[model samples]
Target: MQGDQASVIGGAIEFIKEMQQLFHSLERKKKRRRSLSPTPSPKPPSLAAGELAAFCRSAAADVEAKISGSNVMLKTLSKRIPGQVVRIVAVLERQAFEILHLNISTVEDTVLYSFVIKIGLQCQLSVEELALEVQHSFSQESAF
Candidate 1:
């Protein structure tokens, strides 16, 4: 009975050591993951963001007015502005695909881009030359 008791005590000590090692390993992995994690993203713009939203809506309305006044249906186009990438989709014959994908870094780039796209829709400039022509034309405008 004494020998059996010694063996049982030794087994418990080994079990406890294993548990401690497991806990230590888990803690090390957690610390490694934390250190490798990316910097936190900025907090999203607050309710004051609505001011920018309203301005965008107004600009969209102006563009809508321009397209609607002509034969083109502006409603058929969809836009996705995700961060610095601007994607414009146009549907034709029941199919939809992106027509414009512009990477813009500032409000000015977006504003100028909108003007370029609007003029491209109205003119004979080839797809290859449209961007340059639009930039040149917008640059010539006094309001810009």
Candidate 2:
């Protein structure tokens, strides 16, 4: 009887060890997956997107027009701000809007970035970050 009890205890220990190994493998796979994707999203307060965010609101108000079968409209224009060229795009829906700002410096030749704002919220009362995630998806998938 004592022998049987000892064997059961040994079996329990082995089972626990196997479970630990399985859990560790799962954790490693999860981490690896996270690492392979595009950029992680930045916090809104830290995004340096003040200009872009306001542009989204104004763009929403003054949308030139909407493209059929697609919600994206874009225009590239030289910046009034000296030495800057800007490409602007607006993605509009019933309650949400996404705007991409591609700013290029004519003289620097090295400074360029794209700021995307997704703020056409489905609910008027929805949180700001909720709209941000839609923009985040685009940035996460591509670097520019």
Model 1, residue 37: C-alpha shift (Å)? 7.9
Count of clashing pairs, candidate 2: 3
TM-score of 1: 0.26
Q: What is the C-alpha lDDT of each candidate?
A: 0.29, 0.33
Provide the lDDT at 73 for model 2: 26
State the weakest 10-residue window (summed lDDT) of model 1: 68-77
Q: Please, what are the lDDT tens digits per residue for candidate 1 over residues 67-135?
A: 212222121111223321112222111122223322221221222122112333335433323222222
Q: Write the per-residue lDDT of candidate 2 for residues 51-134, one digit (tens) a residue.
A: 222111221111112121222222211113222221123223333555543332221212222333344535352233333333
Q: Each model's TM-score, in the order given?
A: 0.26, 0.26
Please list all clashing residue pairs in model 1, or write none if there are none.
none
